[model samples]
Target: MKDLLLVLPRLARMIGSLLGDREVPLSAKVALGAVALYLASPIDLIPDFIPFVGYLDDLLLAAIVVDGLLNYVDRSLLLKYWPGGAASLDTAAAVARRLAGWVPSPIKARIFGGRRHTA
Candidate 1:
């Protein structure tokens, strides 16, 4: 859990960098934007008042978005903007994978166009 917490900031920085990079495709930017919007919005798939499960949904959605983004964007470009070391990036990816695992495949297909996106 501590390790996962540590990686979240690095993941945020990477997403920020990707959003600003001209090389990143508009589709990816839009997808990232949607994720951000979803996070900030009060209405969630699960209401925030629901305790642990509510926040779990948010984390799962974030992980899914991160994993999906990695599929469309080039790794080299992501590496360029990453402020943390390669190991940190790997750690973030690991966290994403673990969280994403909890999500059902049908939902993933709906979000990622029927393809299983892996980071």
Candidate 2:
């Protein structure tokens, strides 16, 4: 419970950072923002007074958002901004690549999606 509260922000940041890019659809961006704010709030669907089950709803919500958004969000952006999570992301990508190499196409499409460059 205490641990969940502490890590919630980091999880939200990772989701936001991963989804924060021009290529990301407006709807997805909005949804991600909403979820982030919801997670950061003191109140929740399962009230904190409930003890063990209090945080379940939040965890479920985050999981759903993360799972749904993972396909749409540009993961490279996540790796760049959230360096600690980057290693795990890289490892996952590597495993995915190795296991699914037979399938075609590149997955590095948004390596720079979150950046704002000057001309």
Q: What is the C-alpha lDDT of each candidate?
A: 0.76, 0.53
User: Which residue pairs come into collision in candidate 1?
Assistant: none
Q: Which stretches of candidate 1 lie over 4 Å from their true place?
A: 104-119
Off by over 4 Å in 2: 1-13, 80-87, 90-119
Query: Model 2 Cα displacement at 46 (Å)?
Result: 1.5
lDDT of 1 by residue, 1-119 (tens): 99887777778888898888888776667778988999999989999888898887788889888876655566778788888877877777777777788888676555656543222
* TM-score to true structure, per model: 0.83, 0.52
Superposed Cα deviation of residue 33, candidate 1 (Å): 0.6
**What digit string (tens of lDDT, one per residue) describes model 2 on residues 18-68?**
565566556556667776789789978889779878976665555444434
- Give the C-alpha miss distance for residue 86 in model 2, angstroms: 6.0
- Count: clashes, candidate 1: 0
